[model samples]
Target chain A: MDILPQLILNSIIAGAIYTMIALGFNLIYGTVKFFDLGYGALTAVGGYSVFYFYKTLGINIYASIILGAIIAGIIGFIVYKLVYTPLRTRKSSGMVMLVASLGVLTAAQAIIAIIFTSQFQTLSINAGTERVFTIFGGVITQTQLITLVLGLGIMIVMALVFKFSLFGKAIKAIGDDEEVSKIVGINTNKIIGWVFFIGSAIGGLAGILIGFDTGIEPTMGLSLLLKGVIASIIGGIGNVYGGVLGAFLLAFIENFGIWKISGEWKDAIAFGVLILFLLFRPQGILRR
Target chain B: MTKTAKGILWVIALVIVVLIIVNVSSKGGKNSNTASSTPIKIGFTGPLTGDVANIGQNAKAAVEIAVGEINSAGGINGRQIEMVYEDDRCAGPEGVKAANKLINVDNVTAILGSVCSPATLSFAPIAEKAQTPVLSYCSTAPKISESGDYIFRDVPSDLFQAGFAAKYTYNTLGKRKVAIINVNNDWGLGLKKAFSDAFKALGGQVVLEDGDDPTSKDLRTQMAKVKSSGADLLYFAGFPDGTVAGLKEAKTLKLTQTIFGADAWDDNKIWDSLGSSADGVMYTRVGTNSSDAFKTKMKEKLGNDSIVYCSNYAYDGLKILADAIKTAGTDRTAVKNALYSIKHVNGVSSSLIEFDANGDPKEANYVIDIIKNGKAEIVK
Candidate 1:
């Protein structure tokens, strides 16, 4: 049986995850124009929250996921109300906002460590092997298939939100020109707060999905945030659709590059792709 | 004076008063005892923060527990064992600084750790210059001990673990074709080379090799490519975080087959994270200490069901140091001599830990453990 299709399927699955993380990350970056290093930490929060709800509180996993998303959204709102909102009101420079985000990242990470004690934790209800499925000579797991479906569903919903919703127009308006958006009677501050909420909640969903796929640790967010940022940068910064496309492209390049060589070169291939993109198409495939 | 400046001055004065009081109390203990009766101080340095902090924390915890037991057993030769803990943060420069602190400030006679091999190597030169013996619990590279007389390892190096992992995958698992993925670091690179050599020696074909930057998020592409490579099993030589992430992504894409890794995969968290997906994933580890003595000791101390192998090793490292101190009569050359001549010495981890001339454990074997019911179970 040909393994190429299976590898392609796997790469697509990975791309879906990166898309989710990058989509959320880019939303916040587009609105705030500042990097939130703590975006990854929010994912950890979502994962830990779900773990607590399902494993510790004995809630259903689905219920825990909803609760985790809400918790992440609430935390995002707080980040705005407590840190970002005040700083923006104060008319802080981009660098100051960047540093504040760093503070948030460090504080959020430390809180997770203190709460979870940095132990590797997972939520598995049963002792059973993973079920594998094959289609068209390609193999995959049931969980993975679910992830791919969920990713597409989320992407479609986001696309519709951006296209048809009034709030989406305001966001796009702000993305184009924040001052003009405010002058045109768009509640820029309120819209940005909502953006943080939406973006962070999505980030939280990514975290929960990742926790189910891998395990959750306090520091897992940092790496996730890095990938999300890379995908965003590669896809076309500040563009949701572009970010998703970039994530898939990134996944495909890394997965396909090491077709014959040892798996150890996978990451090198990823960075090489990034460097190639930076060198040739710095504006990205879909520029704003 | 401005309000803030006055406040700062007050805080400084308060700090000075506390320091004076502490110094006075500390001096009282010294003045009451003869200078010749001071305890022999040893140092343990390892990463207390960052990604691999858990490993170092376990090592530190084990050392504390073991050293506590030693001191209670009436310190070596009437000279009490004093230990200094350093947070090396797993960096080479940090390791050097930690070693210097132990030597200069703590005045330790020997040094026990610096968890990663690079960190251990960083401190080895300093220890050799200071003429202090160094025993490590986790640093597994073979070259770590090659620096000379002062450096030793408590466990077998990665050379043995990787070779054994490769041999087991080829012979026991009966896999002819394998694809290997490793983290792009010294630990992963070194282990991969060893495993590659051993796997080839066992007449197995390595179809694909790929590396991941620990910080990289997209590995599905490489994993998918491996699925197409027609490898029977996949091996990942990296930490628990990356291993779980990669395996989960690989599974999602339906590249299902047997997966193998080394001691890096023995983490309890990895199994829990993967849920049902973790089942049938096989990894290797130095056999767990299932002895009654180990159980009793763990029950008395940690009160945890999953007895970590690293923590046990750390505990053994401390006990060995303590034994050396006692046998040597002074925390000086005697402790080092006792450690080298250690014969049939026992600890809670293993029934017997007899160090060879090169400071390598005489007996270290790889046991294949499968993820069953979210916990590792011995397959053979």
Candidate 2:
């Protein structure tokens, strides 16, 4: 097999994962206009929940995934109600919310490490049983295929909801002006809460998919979060479609950048692309 | 001075007085120990927690078993051996702290420990400065051979394993072209250099060489590169987590190249994670010719059949140290000399062990084990 097809497939697989993360990240950022560092820890929450339900309790994989996502969504909703919402009510600055989220991220990660002992865990029931399929001379596993398909499906659904749904319109209005949206009978807090639930559920699904594809560790959330943040910034922060576009672009560049060089430089190439975009197109490839 | 300054000064003065009194009392106690019935203190450090905690804890258990046997045999010169253990967490700074505490606070005659390479390296200088011998049971980095006369290891360095692996791949397997993927760290870099040099010397070509961060979970890009490198064999140097991820990714890509690895892949967790995908993969480690009696004893002590090779080495290390102490009689210089001149010491891992000038085992046996039916079976 030619290397180009494999590289492209690798890029697509990576892009799919990044897209899922960036979509949920952008959705939350669009509504709240704050960087929720705790969003990263939710990925581990989703992965560990599945490990508990599916692996520990012997539940069906599909049910475990759904329950894992719901757990993540509920955690996200609780964080919003207890921390972010109160801070927003106090009219705190974005930096304060960012710091608070960092605190939450650190605490959650520490707790997970204490429980799981910092060991890496694979979520697969049978390690070598996953089916492989060849497409255009590129080999991909069943998990990778599901990840790509679910990533695209979720992106489209998210876009449609934002475009056509009254709830999404209410979210946009609140994002534009929270006090004005309330005066206009938008119920800003309730809509934002729903947004938090949906966005976090999507992030949780990405986590479950990634856990199945690679593996899970307590510290995996930070790296996944960084990739999603980079993609969102490169595409255009707070723009849903832009985040998706930037994700594939970042993935392609990262994969091709290391074609001849060593793999250790992959992270450097990613951050270098982000710097270039920040310098030339600070609004990203798309403007919000 | 202000009231706050005076308060602080008073506290410092009180602390200094308490320290002086404690120091004098400790010295008096040491002087009273000359009657020769006091317990001989030995300090031990290893990763009791963290990623490599299992290996460290196993080594500790082995040492404890050895100590129990020694005490039952009436101890060295009728003085019971006492071990004070500290957890270094398999990190360098923590190792340094543990060394300092063992040498300065616990006042041990010698130290045993530090299962990982970096921890052993970090503690070597401290042990050398304190004139306390350190016998590391598991650290196998090539640099440890030159770390200091006081620093010794029962495990052979990666220099031997890498050369052995390279020769096996080239001469036995007849692989002309090999690709190397390694973790970017001391052990990995050492193996990469040694393997490549040895393979090239054997008239084999290294087609591709790349490094991955130890914590990296995704390796598809690197795997794709290796797949297209036209190499018949791939030498992967990684720990358990990295090995599992890399092998899984390679299997997903259906890469047909034969995989070769180092001793770290001898772990059961890797096999558990890789399952059937681990079949046909080969790795090398220091061969253990442990007696069945010893194995049974260890399993009984640990309450499981999870004894790794390092545990055997640890058991031998404590026995050797005890012998040296018996011959030298509480003198550090005499014990060092005894260790240098020791000969034909029987160990669980080997029938005889003699230290070379560099404090590594002079002659060591290496075994190549292949994963067959998700279990490691000795091939040679």
Candidate 3:
């Protein structure tokens, strides 16, 4: 079709956004081994931080974005220390952790709504001045380009860090067996906490970019989280690189699947692929 | 006592207290038509809490103001009007529950409410079967016109508004090829269908059509598809959040097509968020003929200067029902009949409001609002 370039571009943009989410989500799941539903809400946390700092308080845009990500990371760390650490210490079931994360998500969203009033807000100061770029006859905005570059950049950096760094190997060791890692003096809890920080920071960055691209509301987190979760699962849960591959794959399938169908079926197509993966290829495209 | 025994006793106590309160509250509102001529009971339903709670609460305040004025004026035929407010949460099942409570428990003679279309439509069948005159203030779905003989709304349906937009887009804007993208919900779907039908009738081609889940903010795919279609105009339908997301997506896609929106786009929140991206975007909104006095009264009641136009319609809806009750007494059928023959009652919503044979406002008037610099001004 004459629209192939645009469709492909759309898929890649969607993929880039989802890739950021899936990366953090997969990273956290690797060590903690429980679905951190609250991780989703941190994206809104990051986006709103930028809104408050840059748009509301007149801070530098770059500084606000960095502060937004760091704030999300700190909050993620705090939640780990406060809610999840206690539960893990008590040896709670995965279901209990999942439910707790859900509570965290609900409470965080409510608190945000209380503070900011649930209004969708944009992070960009001047909407009309956005730079546009054309690649292979497909139009892409500056924000989307940044998102794509940053998403791939982050993935590569994370992959290298995991492969070559001592901290990465330690995290992998903990993921393999927390008890064994602790016995070997790798500080499982501390490493897991760092992973949470990194993962949540990435999630928040996704939210910040999304706020600039579209807009942000308190409830935007759950949907973003669901997409990331799907990407992680289908790409092989707990596998960092697999999540990245899964993110792009999911985006491509979602955009291209709806090419001949109605756009409303995008979510259905996403969940359908998730179910298919859960059924036939449970380990996904890669194994951890 | 043992822990289990204590838990069971607490549960039993709670159940008894709940039942007692329910029984007493039920008795307080019903069967009070004794020889003393008790206050006329009227039920009001709107979402006091939910996504559209702001609109619902605004309408509630307006209705309360109307009630205060009517009571100060010695009530309807010397019988003081008593209102029972129920929160439907702007949902279908909740609407049915609220309507049931109003009809069966509260025993209201008439209902002036339900700011949402789904809520209005959900309870219309019950209101019809029970012969309870239901006058909606903000519900604008076309299906409401055929809801029931007893059902009436002050606001004109999306059909007329859609027709207006279609004619304007085609003949006025001179757009022959249009793109349609709407939130996948009753309000969006209804407007999209009506607009498409009207545009097609005017010999306009719908070059691209798409619907996104109402909960989704990402309209990139839809925007991309519409962009490739090279349409001259895009008629986007969504609530505040969805509308903001859709318009922003269109901007990100760098689509050069003129953007048009439906009544839901009247929300200032959308414009506030979209900022400069909202510039040149046009939408249809019902023009209100509210007076300075009503504006002052609303400000006094709400402690704010902001006024959504639906609140004006709600105020008028209550006033119209009160007038009907004054003539027809508390009889539901008589109130319904009186409403149908309302002639030309002047109120805040409009200068002249008369119900036609189909229990709709005879005249449908809408104006185009164009946004620039994050504020909307009526262009036509």
Q: Compare the candidates by TM-score and give the number of the best one.
A: 3
Native-referenced DockQ of model 1: 0.39
DockQ per model, Cα: 0.39, 0.55, 0.48
lDDT of 3 by residue, B1-380 (tens): 99999999999999999989988875654567422468888999998765667788888999999999999999888878889999897779999999999998888899987888889999999999999999998888888889999999999999999999999999999999999988777778899999999999999999888888877877777888888887999999877777777787777667889999988777676777668777999999887888899999899988987778889899999999988987888888989999988854678898888898778898878999999788998895
lDDT of 2 at B103: 83
Across residues A1-288, which tens digit of lDDT does each residue of candidate 1 receive?
576776677677778888889888988888778888867789888988998999889998889999998899889879988998888888899889888888887899889988876665554454224576777777666556676777778778877988999988889888888889999899998899898888899899888877765567777787678777778888998887889988999888766676666555765776777788899988778896
lDDT of 2 by residue, B84-202 (tens): 99989777899999999988877787888878788899989989888889988888889889999888888899999999999899989999999999887777888999999999999
lDDT of 1: 0.76
Q: Report the C-alpha lDDT of model 2 over A1-288, residue by residue, as the tens digit.
A: 589988999999999999999988999998889998789988999999999999999999999999999999999999999999889999999999999999988888889888877677889976767999888888888998998898889888877877899987888787787889999888888888988888888888888988898888787877888899999999999888899999999999999998999887888999999999889899999988
- CAPRI-style quality class for the chain A–B interface of candidate 2: medium
- TM-scores of the candidates, chain A only: 0.93, 0.98, 0.98
Interface RMSD of 2: 1.4
**In model 2, which runs have C-alpha deviations exceeding 4 angstroms?**
A82-96, A177-189, B1-41, B71-109, B126-132, B301-303, B325-338
lDDT, candidate 1, at A204: 91
- Give candidate 3 regions above 4 Å deviation: B1-3, B17-54, B77-109, B126-132, B299-306, B329-334, B356-358
User: Between candidates 1 and 3, which one is better according to lDDT?
Assistant: 3
Candidate 2 chain B has its poorest 10 consecutive residues by lDDT at B26-35
